[model samples]
Target: MAVYTEPTDEELATLLNAWGLDGLRNFKGIAEGIQNSNFLIEVRQGRFILTIYEKSVVLDDLPFYLGLTETAANAGLPAARPIRTQDGEMVQMIRGKPTSLCTFLDGVSSQHPPSSQTRAAGAALAQLHLALADYPQKRPNDLGPHNWSELWAGRAAHSEDLEPGIAPSIDQDLKEFAANWPRDLPRGIIHADLFPDNVLFLGDRVNGLIDFYFACEDFLAYDLAVMLNAWCFEANGREFDLVKGRALIMGYETVRPLSQSERNALPLLARGAALRFFLTRLVDWVTPMDGALVRKKDPRDYAARLAFHRNARSAADYGAPE
Candidate 1:
């Protein structure tokens, strides 16, 4: 259902032929992602994922995204490497959109992953950071705190309609972030969006870390904060799960430990992460794109998260050790 532009069978076969791949047995659209149109492709060589870059993706930034994943995959992480064509090009044009194919990883994403799996995901993310530590390319975090005001500008009424009286809190959050955002922390390339759905797991071990569209250079602890906001919250987003929080931080530290400064900045970083998601979701809710097959996410889910982050006193509040 997420296939915004369906390639004809002949077109798909032609695309595969260019890669020296033939006998395309089956290809079906994957419904999990919202940024790009993805298909589960099966050919004679193996199973793969073909992604059609949506308008939301910047064509020039494709190389940075794909190359980062390649770096992670080559470093023995469970990342899906981009498959190049016979001409050695990692991307091709299909239906006038940039497209790339990657080896399909075998595993399922959990909607409600347990603490054990959450721990594994945390460790895997740390491994990804270590793997890409020396990766030379740089791309700014387009959705970081710097862009929150622009994203939320003139959308106050829309936000208030969704959840009455919520606009002022969001305004105050942006103001607080402007004044108090961390200036010094360990900086590196981060996965940026390691939500549960982005990680594929097999029995508490990560099999694949897919979706590198949001990867960028930023404070590494901010990446951990993103995961904490994502993986440590209950479904309602109101209740923070202490056991999962402990497991996630413990797992990541086993691979790469966080600095005291990073730990101290966790609360604010988590709050900023929550606001980023909220603003993006609010944009989608207020402005529905035609022909885009994305199910608009509600902003209130993150609003609840923001409220919790607003009150959190320190890393210990999030179950991180002293």
Candidate 2:
């Protein structure tokens, strides 16, 4: 749930004046995202998703993510374009939190991804990776490979606190994974978080990618690895729809094919991606935070995914790449 900090119509009108978007209009809260508060701004001329960056998004990195959208749009990829305020900036401040408006994207998320939609999603994601090439900004990767290990080492020690106990041999599993996992693969910009909610769809085609709050400088394959975990796995701990997975990989490879090194590293990176989400979920489960309108995504939701990666050795474990 997207939280809207209560701003009276008068206050918002004043805000528009301050931002030079005056001749402004009405606005209503958008109840969707868990990380930020969003409002649908209805000005006399147009509409936009007014996002108030909640705590999860660091204000300083706003430009990088926003600039990424600009870059993606330039690449002919689908995504929201930021509207400039009177000061000619893409971001602004409202009540201490960074607030900005982006064109309201249409469509809904595809939970049971169709093959065509999956292919389109794959193509767009690949385009995003291509467009992100040579970009000269770096943001802290909250879910980098190293961070995954550190989190496991740190949190494993506190198993008593983490609800899912140290499954008797959790540490051993972690150690074995660390030792056997492949490394030194392709690296670059990654959408560390690409869950269903972050994407939009129309029928079967992906309309746009949203929430680059977790974008970072990491292995490009890592992003694909993230998607494998997201789009391929199903609700009952089953991995279905190999064609969907292939569509994604095919679309991505159409733009930039994975090297042998990246190919070899996919399993481990996929494991790393699974663990990253697991720890975040575990952490959230252990200590639920407050006052955020968005519902915390379940931590245990990715357990089966981690288990699959745990048993993986090559891309074949993910299913034969198309």
Candidate 3:
């Protein structure tokens, strides 16, 4: 969702030829996310997205990512399907980087989503989980709790510079999570980072879910927890919106209800989710890529979310039905 590599006209022509597409009308670099170099291209066949894998996406993992997305799309989900080249390979090379082309999904991503849209997003997420229940392929959550400490190592002073005395609390969170992270919850493929910008909406319905780069095998309820921290938060990231929270959970239940164990473990899972985002954002904040056309998200936002989650007592605190 960023553009570090700019493909030249000849390269674009070669790519289009490889894909058997012609009449390239327009092309432009997308400059939103931090992971990959993305471009929007319109050809004779149709509009499409071209993603050049950057450092964060491992080259070997492309199959899992692309295949999972293809599975979701095949199941009638609004996921962008990866377009194979004329040789039937899902990936190609551009400037020595692993590159891909996917069908362009049609909808606009919301910046400040309403409760109705949040509700739809929740339902879409559940639908995704159900769609991939027997997906067989598994990619471990590389950014899960086990890796947080490594990501958090030696950045306490830098964290303090952003917000005074916040790093100690983050450390405490890590300890608490280590002692009590959930073990026996129902696990499945999860869109681990389904933030507002990742979901596209038309009216109150979810039209598409993009950015499956962070997708992995994890607790199904943990996916909901990620959404809670993402969609139900106020703009300032300090206050939780109860109405939106209730709507989101209720919407998700319409597709797939949470088990009792999942319900019981929500608060801890939420704290862990918030911590995961905070730590990653902290890392990116402290040491940004030199030439990437990407935005360095504020780690303090998730720091605020972590504070809220620390005080949450149970599932009801997140507007889950009792």
Candidate 4:
């Protein structure tokens, strides 16, 4: 349902021909994403994912994303490699929009992943962090704490309409995060959006991580916090699953151990992660894209998550060993 642009057979053949790929057998619009128009392209050569940048994605940041994924793939990470055309361009114009082709990864995304899968996801994330440790390119997190206030501007009334007391809660969260946002945490490239749908699994292991569109440089622990909010919680987003959280943390630490400072900051970072998702979802809910084949995720789900994070005083609350 995320296909906003429909490419014709002729167009497909022309595009593939430019890349020196033979015979476009078939292609179909992929429905799993909300931010971009995607198609699963099958040709005489191989399978690839063709992504057309939507209005939401900034055109200038495409290189950083493409480069990061390419770097991760080159470093032996299970990431989809961006394919270059005969002209050596990884990105090209198609259908009057910036588009790119990436080698298709084989796996399925799970909505209700088991704890073992959660552990694998954590390990995968840590592996991603390590893989990008020496990556020279840097893109600042556009949705980091500094930008949250701007995103919340003029949305108080909309928040109130969604739920009576929600506006005040959000305002308080904004103030708290701004005041307590950690400044000295270790920084690196992070998949700022690592939700369940962005990760693919083959049996119990992670097959690949996709959607580098939101990759950025930020606090490394904050990335783990985002994963915890994403993978360790129940589907309803109201309850935390301690066992899953423990497994995930253990798996991550096996690759990259958290410093004491990072451990101390996890609760606050988790709260910020919940708020980031909540604000984005709230904005989407209030001003949805017209005629877009995308589902509007309920903002209240992250609202419930925000409430839980507020009361979590330490990493121990998230099943971290004391």
Per-candidate TM-score against the hidden true structure:
0.95, 0.89, 0.94, 0.95
Please provide, for model 4 over 12-89, each residue's C-alpha lDDT reduced to its tens digit, 9 standing for 90 to 100: 777787778986787889885676889998888899999988887777888899989999999888788988889898
Which scores higher on TM-score, 1 or 3? Answer: 1
For candidate 2, write residues 105-149 as lDDT tens digits.
788987677767767777777778888887778876776655666
Clashes of each: 0, 4, 0, 1
How many backbone clashes are present in model 1? 0
Which candidate wins on lDDT? 1
lDDT at residue 51 of model 3 (Cα atoms): 91
Question: On residues 1-322, what C-alpha lDDT tens digit does candidate 1 reach at each position?
Answer: 4667788878888889888887778889988566688999998899999998988788899999999988998999988889999999989998779999988998889999999998999899889889999989999998999999999999999988988988999899999999999998888999999999999988888999998989999999899999998999998689999999999999999999999888999999999999999999998888857756556777898989999999999999999988
Q: Worst lDDT window (10 residues) for model 1?
A: 288-297
TM-score (C-alpha, index-matched) for candidate 4 = 0.95
Query: How does candidate 2 score on lDDT?
Result: 0.74
Query: Which window of ten consecutive residues has the lowest lDDT sum in model 3?
Result: 287-296
lDDT of 3 at 245: 92
Residues 80-188 of candidate 3 have per-residue lDDT tens digits of 9999989999999987899999998888888878999988999999999999999988899999999999999998989999999898898999899989998999999
Cα distance off (Å), candidate 4, residue 51: 1.5
Off by over 4 Å in 1: 291-293
lDDT of 2 at 198: 81
Q: Can you list the residue pairs that collide in candidate 3?
A: none
